[model samples]
Target: MKREEFLKRGLGSLGLFAVIPALTACLKDEVNASTNTTTSTVTSDPTTTPSSCSVTNSETEGPFPTKSPADYVIQNIVSDRKGTPLTVKIYIRNVNDSCAIIKDAIVDIWHCDAAGLYSEYGGTGMQSVNLTSVHFLRGRQSTDANGMAAWTSIYPGWYSGRAPHIHVHVYNSAGKSLLVTQIAFPEDVSKTVYAQGVYASHGQADTSNAKDNVFGDGVTNEMSTVTGNTTDGYVLTHTIFVKG
Candidate 1:
């Protein structure tokens, strides 16, 4: 009887020893998976706000701003002023959140044409004198489901002084403005873009982003990331975060 009991006890001990390694491996795997999940989602969490919100830099409205009311929003701002087909896309985000896309935001964009002429402005380089009625390269669109507002436009021409830039204004649903900023381009890209098309006449911008009065202080947040070339056109994208 004693011999039989000892054999049964030895079998039980062997079983426990075998199960222990499997259990340990399973637990370790679960812990590793949990750690990886946390690491992957850290940047995407909306609750993790930055120490300081990266709000879009406020910039001057320039000399030729449209007096059009807020309700006069249009998706296509390019109008008659035409050149290489460039598209401007603005992604709106909440400053207090973790750059989470905010839908239904209003975005207004305006800029000069390849001739350094503003549609609504009348001056030395303008196509028309006192051209307040024109509305080229200017329009407004609401952010879509992905918090993006896009406009089909031409590559802007540079004049003697100012760097090529697009002026942007973002407003909330209640018509309260969240930000006013300018979108700058990379020096090499801007130079290459201006080398051809209608932009070639005036050549590259004499005033670079560093030298530009408005873009001097705050260009890091204002600069745009461009994809594509002058022949096929370019897509300019910038993200703007505003008051939460």
Candidate 2:
């Protein structure tokens, strides 16, 4: 998902950097970053090769995948859920086609709330919370011409065995499944967000990304670039590279 060259050359050529921040601002209650700090680029880790256009890592969608995805095709997934505000911005690119933007791609995302509870499934031997009737923190969006799908959600809380993560399932324009993956948050950012508001009650995640089964290999492509803080909320920008 290398985009440094494209952001500098492609976006700069079309003068899109000036408008990307504005587009991110249109989400209203999603983020509160100043114009100077609101960027729509992937701030890759220096330890990884940022220039490599490789496919994003695929992970399990976890135990609670949406049973009816069509019913939750909206942007704001915060429906009654509470936590530190978080805006997730995902960009889809085609690795088979020279890392070109993949438009009209349907992207679905779901995660746990501040209390480490997922909607639609619980009350069982596995979860034991009884949230089968509610549907929060789950929704879908189609990618725009710029290959971006944004969502207004809250920062996810961690459970015992897994680190805080967002599950993503991508489909093509015709509704063919392309990839099922997960997005990992930066540990420092998660620690900062968890230390505030309702999240503080649950304490930090028991597992680190390096020890988690899904991310134990590496998170070079799955890690998100998170900005902002507990007061103003956080903004996570990540890129998913698929064949399309």
Best candidate, TM-score: 2
Question: What's the lDDT for residue 189 in model 1?
Answer: 70
Give all TM-scores, in the order shown.
Answer: 0.74, 0.81
Candidate 2 TM-score, C-alpha based: 0.81
How badly does each model clash, as a count of residue pairs? 0, 2
Clashing pairs in 2: 123-129, 123-130
lDDT of 1 by residue, 162-238 (tens): 88888888877555678878888777777776666656667778897788899877586777877666556677777
The whole-model lDDT of each prediction reads 0.65, 0.76
Off by over 4 Å in 1: 1-53, 69-72, 123-129
Q: Model 1 clash pairs?
A: none
Model 2: worst 10 consecutive residues (lDDT sum) = 18-27
